[model samples]
Target: MLSEKSMELSRKIIILIYGRAFSFILSLIIPLVLTRLLVKDDYGSYQQLIMIYAIVQAILLFGMPQSLLYYFPRKEISDRSLLIKQTWSILAISGLLVITLFGITSQTMESIFPDHHLQPFIFLLGIYIGIMLSVMPLQNLLILEDKETTAMWSMICFTVIDIIILPSAAWYNPTTLGMVHGIILTSIIKFVIVIFYIYKNYLSKLETRESYYQEQLAYGIPVGLTAMIYVININIDKYMVGLFFSSSVFAVYYLGSLWAPMFGWITQSASQVVIPRMSKAHNNNDLLQIRELYANSVEKLAFIFLPATVLLALIAKPLILTLFTDNYEDTVPIFSIYLLLLPTYALNLGWILMASGQTKFLLRLAMFMSIINIILSYGFLTTLEGDNRLLGIPFATVAVTWISTIVVMYKSLNTLESTLSESYHWKKMVTIGAISALSAIPIIALLSLELENKIFLISSIVIYGITFLFTSFKFNILNDNEINLVKSFLPFKN
Candidate 1:
């Protein structure tokens, strides 16, 4: 039987899974509908708008949002309220400065994007950014407070709001501005929901703590810087493509790099839940608990994502064609290369550094990694244009991710005073990788025959999924505890 702690963790994980699932499904629909509704150039413009918002928000929020996970669970309730107040103050102040700067340098900002309309949308984007930065801490607070069900419900509500508003907005205006309008409204609704809940349940008189503010900023600044660089790590390629290539080209590149949300959902769900737990353990100086949490989290992420990524890779071409239409057939290789990121996702060692508050090391790693990623991606793009151009971004991503994961692994072990062999289940992950590969044999065999695209895709998914799950279960890829945790959520008993 599982311990009480394990059961609680499992319950939190389930709520997070639900949240991610809701967000993931909603995410898929918005992109799919937008891609189909708008022209390729327009779609590309919208993506660029989102990319800009992401970069700005990463800067605006700094690391204040992450500090919630680090400090909330450990802090007294009064201090938690003060922390929230201070974090929001930072976001509002910083947002004002940035928005003002953006308004003043509107021309400079416009020059970065390929479209003139995107320049004006910057205002809406700025407002959305401010709202988002404000709302972020509240969302993380829910997770920290272990209000996972409430968090999940909030996400579901937001999804419902987006689904109803965005498609209609896209259908009517069908332009970048329309999309921005829809997004702004969506953010407003969510902001109100989260803030109202926090205020009703958690907020109190402003309890100012200067030392707490300093501590959060000290820890958060480096994490924020790391995140800012991570923006470069992930989005620099798109920026490069958008800057050099045309809007239409960027659209294809963007679509190609669209990772199935399943990979993100699994890893993100694990990270969000694991971080608070690990932070609590680290605060208590519980080394054994930390070790178990780290190892178990990685294994679960791998067991869930490894097979799904492999299946996606095998059907990358047809999948892209089916989702985005044959116009994006050029996205096949890009999507295929992007699929390679799955294995690397299994090496989520960042949680160790994050929970341990070794954030400066994370900043250093991101700095070095981002520089290398930019250079490699640029070198490839310049050298290989045309059909081979999109390949550069994913190739750079894969290489950089592998290198960063290795470094993080080494640093994580060093931080934990453990070794590679003893610390992580390396052999298990490798075995799972092999299992995922071998399980694709049937799908590969199916590819040899001529069949309808839908039939081929369906057969590949069904065949590959059954094989992977059967192998995982038969080989006991998941431990008894994990199997039980999963079974608890199912209708039937284990």
Candidate 2:
């Protein structure tokens, strides 16, 4: 029988998944519209701008949002107000510091992206970052309040607004700067909503706690810095690509290099489902539960990820051409290379490390991986030319990610008092992956026939879907209980 906590976790995962699915749909449509409406260079510049925000926001939040999950449950009801207030105070101060730093460093920053006129945008960027940073703690507060559904709705609203605004903004002004304005406007609107919600729900209940800030800072800074390193690891390739190729070329690579949303959404949703439970289990020193959750999560994630990875890799060319048009045909190989890393993301070690308060280890791992990425990216850029140079980054990424995954697994296993074999079954993982890959063979054969590009893509997806589902169920890739859990959320059951 499932425990109440397990049932609640399932419910939250369901809510978050539905929210992410809707957001993902909007996400797909937005890129389609913007990639076509904006020029290639403009799209590339927009991507770079977003990368900048990602790095800055990751740094500025400093992982304080994570602390809420750790600290909130321990506090008394009256003490909650103090925690909320202190968190907001710290975020505001950090946001101000970031804005001032950016204003002072605008010229030096401008030199990095030579083609873009960043001088004017620097001030706007600072404001945008400031507003975003200030709102993050409050946003996390919602999750702590068990209002993840509310937070998810806010995300959906913003995405809806983005879809309506971004392409129209690009169409009207038809420039990178104009799209920047659209981004800023959308952010401002979202920021206002967050502020209002935070104030109404949390601020009114606030009280003073001089020591709470110190506690949150101690816990949050390392996590934040670690996250910053992660940002660098993922994004250094973009800088390398931009430096070597034109903005137009960078745009093509960027589109190709996007993480598959199916994998991302599943990983993210699973993390959300497991982290709090894992944290509670760790707090109680229940190694047994930790090991159980860890094993179950990897198995479930592998079941979904292995199949999707194989399917995407098989149909990369048709998928790229159909979605981004023939001009993006070069993206096919890069996309395929990125797909190879999908399995690495199946590891849920970060959640475990965070739950165990081993964030400094994550920081160290991120540093090691980031350095490796930079060195390899540089080597590739110097040694190779054209699209091969872009492909090299993801190749390097897959290697580094695997290395990091192994180290994390070894370290985490020692801490949990479990062997690798006990935590997750290697034989099962390999078997599942092999089975999923073999299932794609018939679909690949069909793709060789001459057909309309869109028709071919659709037919390939439909054929693969039916084949994989029938084979997987017949083989019980996911067992009966797992199958029923998934079906509970769907509208219809077979």
Candidate 3:
């Protein structure tokens, strides 16, 4: 039986997962529609612009939104409102700064990508980033306030509108600049809604506190810096491809390295639910509970992501062709290589550290990983030739990611005053890995048949899923309680 706290945590995770899943589906639809609607070059340009936004947003917002999850849980109810206002003010100012920075840097960017004529689109991206940064805390705010359902619905509505507007804008104009315009419009709408919601529900009176501002900055800055470097590390491969290759070639690389958002959705949703509880445990000086929480989160994530990693890698060919069409068939190998990072996703290395308030360690780790990633990517690209060089980028990324995961795990165990075997469910993880690998044997045989792309893909997935589930149960990888919990969620459970 689950404890009350455990049940509550599970409920929150489910709500967040539902929200992210809906948003992820809509997000996938945008690329699917746009890839068919726009040329490869235009699509590549759009991805580059988005990459810029991701890097800048991660840097500028400085992890203040994340700070909410940590601080809000620890603060008094009276002080929480002031904290929200201060965080929002900081984000709004950062948003303006982003716009100014873009104004200054757009010309330089245009010079670098002379063929793409990126100056105009860079300016639009600045505005979009500004609006989004200001509203970034809305979801976290809702979750903190016990409004998870509202938060879930809000995300669905926002993504629904985004899917409708973004593709329609691209359809109408069919250019990279047109897509930026659509994104800016969507950001503005989201910005307005978030402001209104925050004011109406949480901000009756305007309060100012320099101390509160200072405290949040103290916490958020390190997290933000870590996130900024981490984002750069993960995306360095894409940047390398974009800078060295033409837009068409970059498009192929982007498609091949495109991470399925489902991995992020699962990890992030779990983190959002678990972080506050872990913080409370930390506050109580409950090291045992903290380890339990951390281990359980990783174990549950492995149960899903481990098998998913194998299944996706197996179906990479037909999956890419089916989603982005045969035009992106070149992406298959790159996609498989990138999928190597999925197992690392099960680790959730940063959350435990963040909950434990080891922000500086996180920052140092990010810096080290970023430096390694850049050096390896440059080395691989320079050392290899032709498409092999393009392939090297993902290889470098996967290598650095696993290294970081191991380093972080070591640090996390040290912080908890525990051993690796004690802090992690390594035995269970090994079992899950074995089961996923075994399930792939049948999938490998299916591929030998060389059936039609779609037919073979569908059959392989269904067959793999059934085999994995059966083996998981037979091996007692899933307890009876977990099985019942899963069945309870099924529509026909009765």
Candidate 4:
């Protein structure tokens, strides 16, 4: 039998997974609808504006929202309200500042991307960012307060609204500007909902403490800096592609670089649930529990993500052509290159470091990776010529990302006073990878048959899924506890 704490953790993870799975399905519909409704150049411009919004939002939040997971588990019940209020105030101010910054920089951006005419959309992006940043902590607060079910429902509702509104707006006006307007409207709805929820649950008996502000900032700023660098590192490839290519070409590259929403949904949900538990273990100075948590999380992620990487890489060509149409056939190679990142998804080394209060280490590591990525990207881009050069961007990104993952893993193990053999299930992960690769032989054979793209794609996926799952089970890839946990979530009782 599982302990109460273990059962609680499992329950939270399951709730989050269901919510994210629904959100992922809704998110996929957006690209399918938008790609058909808008021209390539217009789509590219919209993506560019969204990219800017992402960078600004990540930078501006300054990690205060993330800090909540670390601090809340350690705080007294009476003191938690003050912390929430302080964090919200900081984010609200940052939101206003973002709006002002966008207003000031709109003309400059217009000059930079003269063809895209992005200037008109900048202010709306600013508004969306401002409102979004204010409500960013809603999920964190809900999870910490033991309201995982509420958090899951909140996410589902938001994604449903986004799916309905965004494509409808684009269909009505069919322009990048129309899409921005749609996004702003959705953000407004989300903002109202989040604010009301927070006030009703957390602000009724508000407390204030001037010193809490400094304490949160001290913890958050390094995290914020690390987040900024990390975003830049991942997005550097897209930025390079946008700068060097036409909007239409950039749109193709963007589509290729798009990671499956399912990847993030799984990794992020796992991290969110694990981080709070790890923080508590750290607070109690229980290194053994921390090591067990870290190892188990990585192992479980590998079981899913490793096989996923193999299967996705095998299906990349058909998947890309079918999703975006043949106009983006060139994207197949870039998409394949990005599949290289999926295996690394299993390693959430940063979560361990964050739980241990190694924020500055994360910042420095992020900076190092950013600098390496820039150099590698520039070298690849300038060294090659023509369309082939675009491939270099993903190549460089994958290389540097792996390098950073290894370094972080080393530091994380050190913090736990554990070695790689003790802290990571290397043998089990190796077995999983081997099984996944062997299972793909049939997929390769299926790919050679002459059939319609849709039929072939569906058939190949079915074959691969069955082969992989059967082989994994035969090999005992998942332990009894993990299997039981999964079975518990099934509708039918054993």
**Model 4 per-residue lDDT tens digits across residues 347-456:** 74588899988899999999999999999999999999887699999999899989998998889988999998999889989999999899999988887786788988
TM-score of candidate 3 on Cα atoms, chains taken together: 0.95
In terms of TM-score, how similar is model 2 to the real structure?
Answer: 0.92
lDDT of the candidates, in the order given: 0.79, 0.77, 0.84, 0.85
The full ranking of all candidates by lDDT, starting with the best, is 4, 3, 1, 2
The weakest ten consecutive residues by lDDT in model 2 span 485-494
lDDT of 2 by residue, 1-494 (tens): 45556645666666666777788877788789888888897788888877888888987887877877777766677787777777777888888888888787776667776455555567677777887886666535665677767767766887898888888888898777888788778878877887777688678867665565666788888889987887777777788888778889889988887755245766666675577677888989998898888886787678777887888887788888888899999888878887877886777467788788888888888898899989988888789876577788778877777888888888879878999889996776887887788888887787678778788778878888888777777776655655566666455111
Better-scoring candidate (TM-score), 1 or 4: 4
The residue pairs that clash in candidate 4, if any, are none
Model 3, residue 25: distance off in Å is: 2.3
- TM-score to native of every candidate shown: 0.93, 0.92, 0.95, 0.95
- Model 3 lDDT at residue 41: 87
Which residue runs of candidate 2 sit more than 4 Å off their true CA positions?
Answer: 1-7, 107-116, 137-140, 261-263, 490-494
lDDT of 3 by residue, 447-486 (tens): 8898888998889989999998899989888767675555
Better of 1 and 3 by TM-score: 3
Which residue pairs overlap in candidate 2's backbone?
Answer: none
Better of 1 and 4 by lDDT: 4
Residue 111 in model 2: lDDT: 70
User: How good is model 1 by TM-score?
Assistant: 0.93
